[model samples]
Target chain A: MSTAFDAAEFRKALGAFATGVTIITTKAADGSLIGLTANSFNSVSLNPPLVLWSLAETAASLPVFRAAEHWAVHVLASDQEELSGRFARRGIDKFAGLDIETGVGGVPLLKGCTARFECKNAFQYEGGDHIIFVGQVLNFSRSESAPLVFHGGKYAHATRREAPDAKPRSAALSGSFNEGFLGYLLGRSHFQFFGQIRAQLADQSLSDDDFYLLSTLTLRPLISTSELDAGLAAVLRQPSASRLPALAERGLVAQLAMTAESDVAEYRLTEAGRDTALRLISAAKAVELEILERMGAEDGAILKSLLKRFLGVVDPDASVLWDDPTQVAGKIPGSGWDS
Target chain B: MSTAFDAAEFRKALGAFATGVTIITTKAADGSLIGLTANSFNSVSLNPPLVLWSLAETAASLPVFRAAEHWAVHVLASDQEELSGRFARRGIDKFAGLDIETGVGGVPLLKGCTARFECKNAFQYEGGDHIIFVGQVLNFSRSESAPLVFHGGKYAHATRREAPDAKPRSAALSGSFNEGFLGYLLGRSHFQFFGQIRAQLADQSLSDDDFYLLSTLTLRPLISTSELDAGLAAVLRQPSASRLPALAERGLVAQLAMTAESDVAEYRLTEAGRDTALRLISAAKAVELEILERMGAEDGAILKSLLKRFLGVVDPDASVLWDDPTQVAGKIPGSGWDS
Candidate 1:
């Protein structure tokens, strides 16, 4: 282990400490704006309001920050990853075309940060290869935006942890159903959410299988029986083969012209079917919006992100359903994924 | 905003920059262990392996810390939240029963931390009401455990973010089935996961509704028809009413005595039914393990945590299905949740 104590390992050890991404900005002696991405910023004191961040001694902006009387630290928000990337890069104009606010000593302040601190450069201390700059915060402002996290040498999402007492108690029966099971949570969330949209379906006289078939058909203007079956395999109990003909009989669906390339029949939603599908979809979207609002934006985003990652891990090949032409261009006739 | 530059506001702004929790430990002049919880630690340089953290001037151990020649910084893991709390409190024997390793200068080093840095206190700088101690690291180590994050004054879970290029492309047809939709993700994830266990159900000659009934029945030893219906309402198309009687005929379930309070008959899993349910559940759990393993432990945990939170927001009342007696003490007949 001692033999492996190299620079890469040292960096890896340091990466274990997660930190929020920040951009420290200052105005140079010649009035040029200088800024760089950093995750080393931390609050040092509360009474007199002091914060500290470090810059490499050989950094291009070292002299500018050294001579600066005042600077600002902008804590990037979750949505500001692109801005963080911009400032972290070298030799590019970081502030070009950006909406900025001038802070104390003419330091450039970026917009939409989760928090910003305008500070007087209090002291600079020497370190091995960096200059530690401590600043007395003169003024600051903050918003409720979620902070952008950096960990393990990559960007990450931070979700609030549940209080220990808030965790759901186990069920009475051992080896029975665990409400905390991933399967139960997924199933309950899906069914409960769909339950809210069931009334609209009932008003329209649409069955569960019917709604599944109709929604699957909307993915493309024309879908072959084979492709439709593949997509609806998980949600549908009855085959689309039997359901499509009934929808065609109702004039809600129509069969498309057969391409000589294959004998499989293609189907498309008729005008009535399209209208019915869209109305119910809008209602489903409304239910989604209501539930997401209850969960709040931060958690809602985290849930969706984690679900997407889970899907990627469990169903990597399911992308064909979304028809990303790159994967299934020739597989689907007249695919418009790229078009 | 300038007029509101109070301590609370300043603290709020600083909280916007998330940080990993750490416990800085040192040995007092009298050989007592001194440790405190902090999130102000940051790495300042690599060449000299320097790190820094601040101690409030008013802290009880300030005198010991100022005189200490060496200290250790332990970056807490996600499971170390309780330990962090313990060290944060005052007037307690913080290291009373802990297994500690003595580092340089007899500093107490903690176990199970994400990272540990043993450092020689090299410099002390004054910052308003705090003293910033810069340490040159003499030795350090790191583990792969996920670090505990602090954001907005609360502990948070940090999950790795997907690369921008890795996000799934939007569907070609806009208003159709978006694979990225939260509802679609929930539905697809649930269905696909359950799809794996369907083969076991089929082998057991059970339909989807029958399986749902069987699983719900396992939640309690004796579940009344009304309570069972409420539980299975979401996942089952046909009510447990017809399914339970059929299961009884198949010798998988049995009807219990009717109470004078109501004419409703309760049902319990027969020995055969219990065996069948357990077999299927174990199979489902196997599938879950496979999928979660593929997703990695870190992402799997984050996924489950987020899903649990999602369920809390969408279906707080669903706890009754799990038969948490505190929530539905008299609602279910013969509930043994607390047993």
Candidate 2:
């Protein structure tokens, strides 16, 4: 408990997580509506034409956001970090000095954006410390302009100029990758694909040794505990510790066999473990496809990992400012990223 | 024309495009090496384990990164923004006074990172302002730690706790998603899956409208432009723009003589256009799958749009930083992300 994670510390970790810029809105008093800037927005469906974005526990726009006939989500342009900053702040009368206007859902639509999505409230859900609002996008639009960038914790515009003269690595995943995951292979010529699995077991934390055990399970499942170390090392591509017995003792894994000579220890996904692994894999795959599409098919592998690093931010339900925008949107200055 | 996209303007715009965090290293003078921070890393393979990352043009660590035995990528942990910041700056010995170590490929390993990937140079192409270094990740390791984030050219971390309390909207793309493009949908999920796609298109840029038109043609061939607009509007949820007979007059689409009462125009992929569309869509689909695998299923949607924003980073070439860590290593300030 002494090494407790603090807000600033965790914020540093979480900000590494990526997110989409969205604005949450609802009708206000005096016959008009109010909205706030956010990067917690997400899409939920295509069949029903639905969308979703999250809010913090500290948002000032809550009442209005919850009180509208329709709230709209404007997917900020890559150059709209200022807009994201403006609306994310509290007590600023967001739309007062802006050139925003209302559209289909009568929600505030920011100016100079890449796309606008007008929606009616579809559903709301409680997630950990945040509120998840699902918007049924009633109308949407796109522009040729680029959206703003939100990396780490800063706001930036796009560098539309041409890149320098050298060609780097190919983005194709298999036979073209050199690192972690999303390396490449076959059948990717025309179709998009992704998948994985996730679960919260063992306190939602696993050690390097623990991860080795899991990867071993992925590569070769069901071996005796004694042989697990070697198997894990092989599959893990590094030297591994003798981790089987401890894991088994904890019931996170098992021996499950009898007879001394024939007795063996192997690694496999526990019911909970399997569930989590699958979920994680599925999520990773899903993002891989997205990066390829967005980059228009360049650097498929890089985008996948980049997206993976920002997972926390993308989850949206996990933020504090989700409720009160002002505090969350405070301009702490100093390059904004240097925690 | 003096303001026709100056370097600073492009740099500002490029800053708006968020990226992930990574460190690129090169063997230093006196048989040692230097490594610095970066957000331009990406994945490239799976079967043989390939990956890529970019280095910026003005980075101080270029000399060593260009001469390293093997470059390793340490996907920074969310709690490690300080580490990202330190490495991103110049004038200090990056590897001094830290508990840093090295593993495979003789590459320096940052402590407590989410994962470490060791790679052998696979491909190196020059594009625009960055040098793309593709590596074949010979070995890799992972730990259950969160990663640092980058946004708007700065580092950001999350403010999440293990338990749920008074947060606002749950940011999880958790409940269900409805409003999205198969284009947008596929764009996010595929790469995070960390799978590979074999593509056949050469590098080229297409307008958003053109990309949509081409995608439509790839999905449903021979549909007229009007039907395309209607279909696209349905997909986009945006009202179709008012396009008069001028398109037909310009032969972008042609009038059908089959209608006696009215001349219904038909839009078909031109022979050249068809070839181009087929090539581009094929390439786009391939990349989309790669991105999907990278985004993962849990935060799939946000990853979709997030990467969509990143793609707008202006690769300077059709190629992007797939996972090499060398393309943009020296180019921007603040290590090119939220450090």
Candidate 3:
């Protein structure tokens, strides 16, 4: 049964306990700066301000760390993934290009971290294949930046969970829509967000379809009737057959001569249309700012990220209308369009 | 400068290092199970299999842990927040109602964890105000559940970070919509999601507005014209005046006679309309399952939670239409409606 003690399985089990990424740095006896990435760091005691991290005995820096009288632990921020990667590699100068500061006993310190601890080496204990170094804190500092988390052997982002009492409101009747329904949430979010921009539309005397058509024109200097139809098909039903001519009638859009010898034609936004679209877009952005500010910055980032991923899953080929001429040409052979 | 090392500040600085929540449990000599919440656990070695965690020397269960020959570490799942709270409390039977199992040397093992490690106590080191217990892991098991994280002294949920190279596609023209724009993301997600269910709507020979009206009817047995207008004001510009009549013409909706001496009228779905709505809703739910499965369960959960929170911010009062009778009564005077 002793053979059942698989190291890989043991390591995988240990990975279940998530921890923040940290880089421990120190000055060696040979006067060279040494640092390595580690997540084994933990607080051991508070009364005497003791913290500990283990270094593998087989590591190249083990001798340096064992002899060091002082060292510093830098608790990385959410945006420091590159730094973590740099420190995790070996046989290279990790501090070569960084703006480094000297901590207790001239130990190297990295900036832009969530927290930093300068400590004096106190005791070392044997931990089988590793050596555990316990340090007495000399000084420490912290910032408001969110911490970088490592979980299941990969980097992760951590967001504050909703309060236990903040459960989703249920629908009054069975089989009815509720706050938990994804469709209801998406529809409500889209409508409520656009609700703020509708006032600007009313002021400009532009209908919702008119606004959609004008925005499509702004995506390119001139959009073909087929392209417009394909782009706005999901929302406007038949944009070219209906809304485009209405916009042209109002002098907000102008029909362009077809460069090819075919009945197909293109449309471009008039100066008024462009100006109106820009104005409304700017106003919509302002509303977005107000909403995202209410949602915490971290949550806002996460929401946008997940939404983009969702779009990637459901609309992988929906970028045709927004593609540059070069990309469009690549996708459609012999189009000859160049950006 | 030593005064800067105040316990509270030091504690706050230490909390900058995020960690996964865990409960290390062991059996006392008297056959009582002892478990306490901790975030101090960390992997110390691979060969010979060692892990360590610190416990306050003054803790009530320290004696039991000190004399125990075996213990188990349970890495908690995201759904175990209540269990974490229960174990973190003092002087109570934490496992009184839990479905527990006995591990190596009869240590208590909790179910429904991300991972579990059974260990033999190998060494105990003195750590100022605490003692560090290092264990040699005997055997372990893991599950695919997402881990529960702790950061900044609060419970957190961990989400996988986006791949470094998956940047949002840029717009070809300046001031045009890109994949990163929140409005574009929301609209595209809404339409693409609905795009999948549109085929079901087509089979029923119903337009988008018709489907929306029919679904809204299912929220209540009968809805007043004014209430329909208020509920669908965002999507359907004039549902009662336009779409409701169209559905009524098709024999899907029927107008109800006024029971009171008022000019207001109400509408309800016919048997045909109700069946059509149920079929369409079932199809939509199937589409939701497909999309969410592609999004990964954890991310899908996070996305829906964030969307609900966003609605809470922008459309807090949007629930007026779906309010139960009691809430409606509180909202409107003398409407004798109750759930």
Candidate 4:
């Protein structure tokens, strides 16, 4: 690292300008495909239908691109991140097993991109250590897939901004616990979502705790008392121990004999229990689908993504709820689970 | 619109490429300052510290930019969308009332951008209906502020893609009700969040329903039973009517005489009730702050944003919780709330 204005610093500064990830592809003179990932792509002019991108002079495919009469730029979708990484790497055949589409001038195009622009190489300009290639669009197509973004040298998810005019509904109670608070929003969203599902639970005379316990049973074939206690640690106000007996009496759950290795009691969902839990789960999922559909796919995906990440921080031990039964042997006597 | 290859369609294709908003500024030869917002900006070379952007050939400031010796590129921060729009418009002084910093060659620099690059005009190229100006970076600085992104002709939020290796912690229980379920995540996050606040509520011996009723009173000076019922409709399992009398018995609430305008009973939080609600709210907020901090500011903001949007879809009448007291007159008899 040099003391004065280093290259890494300059690269970081440039990265502050987020751009869509693009894979620029062309055919080599030897009849082989050529493509490389670049975030340097941008639109230059609309009337003449022009777009431009630059390539490092040191790139291995530079010679092929320089002589190519045309190339295709594929704007990757949010789901195409793996493809971006494949094209960005050095040595392996990038198009292996991929269904490639041949565009103008025999340039190979990748399917499922958010947008594709087939262009005729129109102008090349000197850009120290690189060559800026400007192309006139010959033909193009676009889809509604959410765009993948590159910022600060990392892949990102770009979500549509809320309309500016959609201000907080009211300032009537400026400082009150309104929709602006995260806790209130989460609580409200959770309760509202379950308010609909609770009706389904009522049909079976199951309490919220019973639903939680039954749902946990559905996650694995058999769950021990300790596992249930650990899994519902944050969810149930009381120990799951007290609730299991009632569920067992109701025939929704059945107790199993102690295993050879451990003396703890285990439980499994009976046929009736599995039927009940799945029925309730199916209903819950329907509510989830309706809310998600109303929010639209892109926003719904982002909301779930953020929730998963937030859960990573707030509930580091959340994995307990879905832990594999085979890994139960490794559970220390009282360390991980009891803590 | 044309029969083939229309400009509007081409523009839509180009919009699929997301880009960060940039405001390029420089002093005109005559000493007047000139600036315009452009997303047609990209880094051309790393070793030589080169960047480029383009302007429409028919623009009013093209001539100024073409001959300008120096210009600064300001990568707008997420909070600077207003400034981006200001510089994007035609006519009027865009620099008026701005706290400007003079950069290399006396170019005006705006404050609070994610990144700023001062460069010397090094080359010009013909780009169809636009003029491409390449610049050699002479000085630059960057901050950690999140960048503002423009995608599909709308402003968007760019959130970092989760680590590829951070898969769903377990597929151990495939297709079961587990952490991967959105409903489960929302419920867990909500309960985990409140689990911390319940202790504070327990100090005052308040049930969850009691807290809901008490918090409703905090939103306005006086809340009628109808308003409380409407506000807590989605939250409380039973009607608020059954819960308020208990709170009144606790001296946490005071019943007011029936108002002249309506016959419904109204209630206000007593000093003790207000104090208790605020205290519990403060504790919940501290929990929120801790979780947000643990999740990092960027992800936390994104989470809250998505939750707010999700709430909009699921709870259409959520505004009732924060409605203005004066709007009580508009309550159509047994129509909106009673629904």
How many pairs of residues collide in each model?
A: 1, 246, 0, 0
User: Which residue runs of candidate 4 sit more than 4 Å off their true CA positions?
Assistant: A1-4, A224-227, A257-266, A317-319, A325-339, B1-4, B257-265, B317-319, B324-339
TM-score of 2: 0.29
* C-alpha lDDT of residue A125 in model 1: 91
Residues A185-296, candidate 2, lDDT per residue (tens digit)?
2112102222111122224555534643553444334655545543222222233335555665555665566668764544555666555445544454465445456554
Compared with the true structure, what per-residue lDDT tens digits does model 1 show for residues B1-339? 232699998999999999999999999989999999999999999998899999989999999999999999999999999999999999899998999989999999999999999999999999789999999988989998889999999999998876766535554466665755788778888888888788888787899888777887787778888877787677778777778888999999999877788799789999999999988877777777787887677667777777766666666566356646675654433322111
The top-ranked prediction according to DockQ is 1
Q: TM-score for each prediction?
A: 0.94, 0.29, 0.89, 0.92
Native RMSD of candidate 3 (Å): 4.8
Sliding window of 10 residues with minimal summed lDDT for model 3 chain B: B330-339
TM (chain A), candidate 1: 0.93
DockQ of 2: 0.03
Q: Which stretches of candidate 2 lie over 4 Å from their true place?
A: A1-4, A157-339, B1-339
Docking class of 2: incorrect
lDDT of 1 by residue, A161-246 (tens): 87755535554355555655677668878888888788888787778889988988777778887887787677778778888888
**Candidate 2, residues B1-339: lDDT per residue as tens digits?**
011333343333333323456766545556565777866554333334455555654555655666665777777765566777778787887788878676655566666776666677665544224445667656566554545556445553322211112232223333121112122123323322221221131124333345445445544334555565544432222222333243334344333444776565555544565566555554545555544454443233333333333433222222222333454455343222111
Interface RMSD of 4: 4.3
Q: Candidate 3: which stretches are off by over 4 Å?
A: A1-6, A29-31, A171-173, A317-319, A324-339, B1-5, B170-174, B259-261, B317-319, B325-339
Candidate 3 per-residue lDDT, tens place, B1-339, comes to 122768898999999999999999999999988999999999999988888999999999999999999999888999999999999998788999899989989999999999888999999999989999999988788887888999988988888777665433544455665555677678777877887788777886788778778888888888988888888777675557677777888889998977668777789999988888877877777777787887777788788888877776666666357666664444533221111
- The per-prediction i-RMS, to one decimal, reads 3.6, 24.7, 5.1, 4.3
What's the C-alpha lDDT at position A74 in model 1?
95
